[model samples]
Target: MHKILVTGGAGFIGSNLSEELLRRNYKVRCLDNFATGHFKNIESLLANPNFELIVGDIRNIEDCQKAVDGVDYVLHEAALGSVPRSIKDPIMSNSVNVGGFLNMLVASRDAKVKRFIYAASSSTYGDSKTLPKVEDVIGKPLSPYAITKYVNELYADVFSKTYGLECIGLRYFNVFGRRQDPNGAYAAVIPLFVKQFMNHESPVINGDGEYSRDFTYVDNVIQMNILAMTTSNSDALNTVYNTAYGERTTLNQLVHSLKEILAEFDPEIGNVDIKYGSNRAGDIPHSLASIDKAKNLLGYNPEYSLRKGLEEAIKWYWENI
Candidate 1:
């Protein structure tokens, strides 16, 4: 069995990926600092013999190096996520997302890992008004968070070209599902809305509630990461793919849907109030993804739609969170 090291494996997407890896009989080592990630995410897997957990900061080269040792592949997911968080503190975002990514790249290169598959973001699409975002085309980044994620692709490309390190980036669009924290200020919109409505609190929709996103489920992300780590095509090795279900959902529509879904849990929650706030700084109007590259190249096929994904996500949030 191949050994894979998953950074930030205690977080939402990372934890799910780690569980899938373990399910497939991979020797897994999970490295995380628990900054935004919670230990509860990985608590169930602690008894697994093939899984190992290392609580450490990715910003530390020693931790990165130690985590990569003898690992056949690296799924780099550690980062300071959220555009609003970045705007509030660009330095922290840059240091962790960008600086920490470079540290992992150098460490993985030196460790001679099979491939480096890092988490890129849809935020990198920024101000590009394109209906469905393509991998080859993108506009200037809108937030410090987007800039950091963009820089990740740049660094991975440079590493592959300069040092012969194979890297593939997956630009995930609005991923939300199990293990996603809904309490924090930097929480993703879907989970935040679900939690607020469950608690009878009015969820705030930034902008006019018209800002849309290609809301992807986390399982599709897990599939793409597996494919990326295993594929050997030279053409596909260095390029990035849009890891999404190729659909868009507006915040207004999203809130209404969440309320409707949560109604099954408590009918009273069906009438959850919504408050519209002024447009946030460093915000984009629309985000839609073109998953064609991922489809043609990686054999990637997303199996969940927004409603389907939110159904499971809402159930998990109501039960665990």
Candidate 2:
């Protein structure tokens, strides 16, 4: 069986990825410090014979090396996410997202992992006015969080060119779906909105409700990771691809869709008030991705649209916390 290492394996995306990888017959080792990740996500997986859990910080060099030992591939997803969170504590964001990421990269290279795939964010697009963000051209980093992700890409590129480490970066745009925690102050828009609508409370729109996003689903991210790790093409190596739905939806439309769908569970949900507030500091006005590269290169055909993903997310939020 192929062996794989997943950093941040207890977080939202990492947990889902680990499950999918194990289901596909890969031996999986999950490494997490449980800083932002939760043990509950991997509790059942610990029972599986194919899965091993390493409770250690990515910041520690020895921990990183031990996790990567005997693994064939590395899925690097451990990071302090959220722009506002990074804005509040840039040093914390940098330490994990940038510092820890480097540790994993060096360890993976030493372990001779076939491929190193890490999560990149649309925040790297920063202030670019372009409607659909492209890889070659990018704007300045808006927040400290964006800078760390961009630096990951840079270091990955250098590693590939210098040490022949094979790496692929997936630039995620507004990723939201099941297992996305909603209790934190830096909680994403979708889960936070779902939590509010679940309790018949008013949902707050950060801006005028005109701000938009690609809002890619987690399943699509899973597909991209699997495809990127298993691909045979040489040109596809050492590059970045946008993992998104390739369609944009405004916050107003999103809120209305959530309210309408949640009404199925409670009719009172339809009447939930939506409050408006000032736009966020680092928020981009509009975000849409050009997934053409991913389509042609990685066989990444997104199976879920925003509406489809929202339905699944609403169902999960309704069932889970």
- Candidate 1, residues 1-321, lDDT tens digits: the string is 999999999998999999999999999999999998889889988999999999899899999999999999999999989889999999999999998999999999999998999999988888888788988789999999999999999999999999999999999888999998887888888888887888899999888899888899999899999999998777789889999999888999998899899998899997778999999888889989999999888889899989999998988988886
Error of 2 at 49 (Å): 0.2
Q: lDDT at 254 for candidate 2?
A: 89
After superposition on all C-alphas, the RMSD of every candidate to the true structure, in Å, is: 0.9, 0.8
Candidate 1 residues lying further than 4 Å off, grouped into runs, are none
TM-score of each: 0.98, 0.99
Per-model CA lDDT versus the true structure: 0.92, 0.92
Clashing pairs in 2: none
lDDT, candidate 1, at 301: 87
Consecutive 10-residue window with the lowest summed lDDT within model 1: 230-239
TM-score for candidate 2, please give it.
0.99
Q: lDDT for model 2, please.
A: 0.92
Residue 104 displacement in candidate 2 (angstroms): 0.7
